[model samples]
Target: MKYTVKGTQEEGVQACAKHFIGNEQETQRSNVIYPDGTEVAAISSNIDDRTLHELYLPPFADAVKAGVATVMCGYNRLNQTYTCQNSKLLNGILKEELGFLGYVVSDFYATHDGVPAIEAGLDMNMPGPWDSMTAAMTYLGGNNASLWGQNLTTSVGNGSLSEERLDDMIRRIMTPYFHLGQNEGFPSVDPSGYFITAVTAGYIQTSRGAPPARDVRGDHAKLIRRIGAEATVLLKNVNSTLPLKTPLSIGVFGNDAGLPADGMYVLGDDPPYPGVPRSGYEMGTLSVGGGSGSGRSTYVVSPLNALMARAKNFGGRVQYILDNALIAKGDFSTLYPTPEVCLVFLKTWCGEGTDRASFENDWNSTLVVERVASHCPNTVVVTHSAGVNTMPWAENENVTAILAAHYPGQESGNSIVDVLFGDINPSGRLPYTIPRREADYALPITNMTGDQSRNASAWQSDFTEGLYIDYRHFDAMNITPLYDFGYGLSYTTFEIVGTPSADLLQKELPPFPPSSQVEPGGIPGSGMKCSKSRLSSVTQDQSPAQLLCSST
Candidate 1:
């Protein structure tokens, strides 16, 4: 509703359906399909119809048809090519096919996504004063308008942006500007008046997105809760430390306990809550680099609250430790002279699609596990975070258990309790590799750059691993992630028929059902099975083996 109609008509703002083809969830937002919405867990693939119609492409189609005034270009590359500037999306489809006459906008700082966006037929590269080649061109003479024209004219001549391209883009924009009477603001007079109805010949456009049946703003919390519930997962349990079957005393630490709590969403408290740092510096600023709202986006849920909530359900009381003073120290003796299950909630946030600076949990997280192991024997770590991390904590034979709850939203506190108390199965997966450390990245390419092709690392960002960003790279390098991508655990086990056939792997997952589609769930972490199974290695350019299976 917001993207297609509410933001536009209700606010009188030109609603731009962003990321033309498919861009969502910045953690590895481009050139991938999270299938199940996990970024590190994405697979290299094209936009399938289920997504094209349901999730991926529809908004733009709707925008164009409904007479939306603009669309935004994506910052990341799609299929190894920049989308801000992909011609297939811009001139070919948005124009000739969809018949859109409105303008196109590049995402803030997406001038990189811009050149291709202009070639693709995007009209405005915004959050702009153009830079890079676009800036250089602007200095040369052509502003974005002329720079775009020059590039298109050149692309057509040299086969970069394309020639027939210039005319098609020009024609499309001109048609709306002139034929639509846009010369006089399309003669609608009032953007919200009766004139538009009379002039367009039809009030209901084929392209508009339908408004929600009701005001969902009231249920925003409910919606976020459901997403939290479904997305959370129990990753490990060495001795079955979860389901809090019996009532007992609890020991809690970290931000949840509050000696002096991190302001959270407020960013600058003890243990330090996350702040939106601009692209330029770590000092707090309103915007991150590229001048867009930082997606950290202000969400908070403390583990202590969740623990207390769960304990109440089972009839138990909880104690909080104040001050970093080792209430338990390396030993749980301070919290419990007698034994009780220790629960450590590790809250780690790596901006989406971006990998962590290190693969292991911080010393605090490890120390929590260390104390639990020394004193409480029965310990479980409920990690509330986004992305995956190699568990150095797992090294302790006594650590006992783990859970991967990817940024569960508002009701997150309550949801963790439900699952721990046996309400839900942790069915989530590690979206990317939990490599041992930064040095172990066979090519260490996940979330290395926020840019599409800017070279920043000592090792060149390798495209030799093209279309093979996730587990495929792992398989190729024969280097397994500490935790493999797509690794998820369920309360009940799922089995896939081991019918091995290479040819069969090429076939698509059974087409998405009418109501929903395949999110491409499962990776080697889930369990590895290949199509040509008798035993064989792969060569470069040859696809890292694929397996076709049936859930048995």
Candidate 2:
């Protein structure tokens, strides 16, 4: 939060802390009524006060204390009231207890009632006037009415809302602009070509003629490549199979090794039915997940492209088969032909609108890996996924290595090759526990009850698991995970050589510091400071840490 606020505001851009409270699930996330007269109420996260404070509220509090310019209330209800208009959450906890000075904004079309929303301390209703139908057909275009523009004026005229409260809202909204020094020379707003392209498919032109083409990409590719390489977790390397030595013959398999055959810009495809080939959208090298959060790349270098380039440089033979069916059906002797190494790329498709039905990879990715590994002696499997993927073939003897290359952006191919060929050491760690079974999770995604064909009205998700989630749940229940969180591998190793020691300083910590005037970055100098009082000795022959500690 501090980094984002400081960085963005330094460039005259206000940072927004979003989905403010409990918004755990994506199912039934918005208020909408189907054409068949079925109305779906946003799921209410029924969190107890203690659990709310301990688990969900602290992150938001930290964001507020960082002096975030804006906070976007979520789509879900908090204890049965819509978060956009929840009085206790917005006014009581956020503004009063936390002492947040920024304005509260609602998620896109999340606000239901105008009066209740403002009275509950909602300062902004995003995208103005929007109904359920308009929200549902957002891409296709529909009604565009302001929910608060006239309604707010009318409310204040009738004395339903006080003028002072209206002024307070304006003051809150404008405070960040001046606080961030946006009144000084900031870059002029340009027509968003990306947005125009998405909505109108390049059919609509901006009123200012053509959107000015500017290349703001300043060494971002280099940073992205470095991050990608560093984040590639080496899950398995039985015989030091990775850091490839420019083998004479290499065979690459699976759709994930190349770009999607159909196209690159497809978004949001239905999960393929049994026996149907997975759509190009799902099968291709998944640099990013689907839905709103996904970004468009200027160009993507596929694993095939990167490997071919590398092989060309080394005068090596490169062969690849991107079709999943061909790999499943082909004879190993004819297809692979005694290749020195076989690389299998696989991915799981996950995004914003829905939850994954299972932990297994889509389109029988495991079967592909198992099939290839069975034929080839030196098979390396690379997986691109958003989260925990059940690797049934982790124990397979034929599989020599495994790389969890989670959703690396445009530099996906180069990054993987860098790690594979020993150009960069893999140090990425798993952020989530890989459970042996889907049932091992503390809670399964709540399914719609009452009817299968229509949306359910009583769509309430109970937080019965409390704080026992992810690795915490596994620890509490004594359920051994397939791969525990923070599990990662490196080409080299290190050993702790000495006992850690810390300088002792005893002082009674106060419950609260003396109250002060709240600034944009919260109370000045309130952020916790870390002193270099602890030390530990470590030994490593050749590692990143050794380079840093060499001078010491």
Candidate 3:
């Protein structure tokens, strides 16, 4: 967060911390009133105050302390009230408690009521006007699509909202704009290049002009390649099967190894209607995920492309089967003579607006890996995924190695080859626990059925797990995971020689934060303070608490 805000602001851009609080799931995120008169309320994240402060509020608090320029309230309700209009969250926690001077903006079409949201502390409604479908719904009295704009002005005029609150909103919205010196020489926005097209039902086209063709990728490709290589996580290696020595022949399989068959590297080329599943691998390499959070790259380098280039340079033979079905059928022996090594590339697509059905790999990738490993003794599995994926074949004798290459972006192929052929050592670690079975999680993705179904008057998602989530839940339940969090492998090894110790200098510590006046950035001297203490101790246990002060 510090790097993101400082780096972007240094380059004349503002970074925004988003999904304010308790937006855990995406099911029924937004309010909807169907043409058939059926209504689905936004899901409510019912969080206890202690759990909210301890678990969900730290990252956002850190982001505020880092002087982030903007904060976006999420679509879901926080404690049964829409986040944009939740007073305890936006006004109490964010604005007053954390001393966040930046304005609060709503997610796209997330605001429900103008007066309540403004009074609660929402400074801005994203993309003010409603789209055609929303406007039609509003006209039919099914929904109140536009929360601000003319309605906001009328609310203030009719005494439903106060002018003082409106002015405060304006002040908060402009504080960061001037503080960041955006008025001096901010770059002009090229709407044609960045604006969304209006061909879709829920989107309003901001500009009618054709988007200008531009290639703004300066030296980012080089940086991307280096990061990609460093981020590749080597999950398993048997008998040093990796670091390929320019084998005489290599066999590549899986649709993920190449571009999409339809040649659509980027999404949004086709209309985006709700419930219509976007083409995954059939569109190309899974460099990014799907939905609003997905990114766009000028080009994506698939693993097959990088392997073929390496093979050509080394005068080696390369054969590939990009069809998932053909590989899973286990009948490719005639087309593929046994090669020195076989590389199977797999991926799972996940993003905002939806949750994956399971942790299993998509496109029948588990079957593909089993079939390939059965035939090829020296099989190397490379997986690209957004999150945890169950590996049923990790213990197979034929599966010599496995690399968890999570979404390498445009340099996917080169980065994997770099780690595979010893050009780069894999150093990335898993961010979440990968359990042996889905049941091991204990805390399953909540299915709001019964009275809490989508058609119910209100959708409630109780945070029953509390602070015990992910690895913490595993530890509390004493369940062994398939691969623990932060689990990763490297070609080389290192060891610490000396014991670690810490000292506590301050005899007394304040239980609450300083009550300093709120400033543009934050409370003065509110940042954590640490120092060497007179009382010192050393322990062989080497827990992280032993190395740092409690204040830190």
lDDT of 2 by residue, 6-122 (tens): 677777789898787888888777765888877778888898887788667876777787788899998888889999999999999999998999999988778888888999989
Q: What TM-score does each of the candidates earn?
A: 0.57, 0.83, 0.85
Off by over 4 Å in 2: 1-10, 36-38, 132-143, 194-213, 270-280, 449-456, 497-552
Model 3 ranges off by over 4 Å = 131-145, 194-196, 199-209, 265-279, 448-455, 500-552
Stretches off by above 4 angstroms in model 1 are 1-104, 112-120, 127-216, 256-264, 267-301, 322-333, 352-355, 436-439, 445-462, 493-541, 547-552
Name the candidate that leads on TM-score: 3
| Better lDDT candidate (1, 3) | 3
Candidate 3 residues 456-515, lDDT tens each?
Answer: 446778897776787767765888888877778767653322322333356564463222
- Between prediction 1 and prediction 2, the one with superior lDDT is 2
Model 1, 92-113: lDDT tens per residue?
7777778777776676455554
**Backbone clashes, each candidate:** 20, 2, 3
* lDDT (0 to 1) per candidate: 0.50, 0.76, 0.75
